[model samples]
Target: MRSLRQTTARWLAAAFLAGAALAVQAADPAPIELAAGVYMVPGTGGEPDPANLGRTGNAGFIVGPRGVLAIDTGTSYRHGQALLAAIRGVTDQPVRLAIVTHTRQEFLFGAAAFREQKIPVAMHQAAADLMATRCDTCLKTLRSLLGEDAMQGSAMFTPDIVFTDPLALDAAALIGRPIQLLHYGHSSGPGDIAVYDPRTRTLFAGGLLEARRIPDVGDSDLPRWREALRNLQALPVEVIVPGHGPAGDKRLITQVERYLDQLTARARALVNAGAPLSEVADATAMPEFATWDQYETTHRRNAAIVYLRYEREQLVK
Candidate 1:
């Protein structure tokens, strides 16, 4: 098994280079309203490149009579600026807060744009710590891959609000639109969190979930991630704005859960059969998910990761 550092580096490289050969395409970054006051700016899914301008992650906003709450900032300062413009185009309400949902590069770095606007940024304490330790390196990688011009003025900043527990925002102040920030300990990442809007039954499931795209397991704990998905399933979610891919209904949650389960089962079987770690990736291929984005890169890595994890579990037992 690869060391965590080496695995992370490999994952980062693959993640950035996954769909590099495809023709560069641009999509409108305009916000699409999901409900009365909820809107999502869909990402151009795939690896970050000059074509996508690193805007490969979904960002959203919940507008209320009092103010607006932005879901994520985006990948770079320019991306964040585009998001802020999208929000402005819809409403003149002051942006009360901006939430950095997780530690992923696609959802971070853009916080600098929000901070420049004087909008306070919020993050789970764990996510903030993870960012503190690794985002500088991530930023450097982005600059190298996306170019300095694309990443111009993009930088990291400390979150203005950090919470370690589940937090409930003032729905009444938000004009009857209740928003809940939920954290499931160390699931998808150290501090993966989801934003739940009860009124619209919309969930801005950050790093905790993905639709279509393979969930990156580099920093994941499978059992805990499964548990977290179970808890989310209990919610009355009607729509999900995933960390990647287009918004979908409750089924997105189930799809992610199913993928994780299958990935774990296949990896566990390989480990139980005493298969060499080097062969686990090729041996554990799932043709069922072959069409999903990053299946070629992320899924193969996920299989090896789960194999190593289960192998370690057996040793300690």
Candidate 2:
């Protein structure tokens, strides 16, 4: 098997770059406390239009009486600063820890802001390694897409802490709650991890489960991803904060799993029948996902990548 870092490094290079590029001055949206102290800042799930400027993803925080833990920073330094400002307006506790949820430019870039505070950021070791190697390249790519001014204060950074398994923050001892950092093991990428709060039955699933927007498949093992969803479904989670789009119920798990299953099944069938790689797009036609944002721009590439990955796995076996 390829190293996890190698699997993740291909994520953006595989497909995300095919979409249109645009930039604008966008602020991080306000934070909504979904549970007693769990706050979420919902992103504009819409495409990179003038209105949203492609800021599509969710960032949130868990406030314990003693300290706060944030999950996934926004797309820029400005966004992270705005998020911190929002957190300050609501709570007096200091934001102590930050979690890097994925390797996407949107997910990891804003972490620089947290680093400035000497706040330690944590992520899967695979992800941190990949970020360290490609941080500069990803920054340049973001600069090109969002324009230098929009990305002015933004920077690429590696998380200070890395874990191979889940870690628990015993904030309840000091404050009143405890949070679990779960290393779900290769859903959207080799480095994906999630945050869960037992008290609220809330799970910050990261990109492992998505709502309206179809999850990206560039760095995926369809079978493993599907298995990961089943594992997440088994959790005692009431509300889920998807990596992108809005916060949702356990149904998001089913929605994303079904979509992934259908796409993988169709792609594998076509590959078995000896279909051309380019034809994987038409072969795995998904009218059910027609209404989803970025469908036209991203789906075709998703089909091709999934098909190519299956072909690769078969060769390995």
TM-score, prediction 2: 0.86
lDDT: worst 10-residue window of model 1: 14-23
Give the per-residue Cα lDDT of candidate 2 at 43. 73
Candidate 1 lDDT at 73 equals 91
For residue 149, model 2's alpha carbon misses the true position, in angstroms, by 1.8
The list of candidate 1 runs beyond 4 A from truth reads 1-24, 168-176
Candidates' TM-scores? 0.90, 0.86
lDDT tens per residue, model 1, 1-317: 87644543443333333323221465547677776698888787888887888788888899988889999998998888888999999999989888888899999987888999999888888989999999999999999999999899999788888878755444335433578888889999998888888877788999988878999999887789999999999998767788987677677788998899899899999889989999988998888789988999999999988898899999999
- Give the Cα lDDT of each candidate: 0.83, 0.74
The regions of model 2 sitting more than 4 angstroms off are 1-25, 48-54, 168-176, 314-317
Judged by TM-score, which candidate is best?
Answer: 1
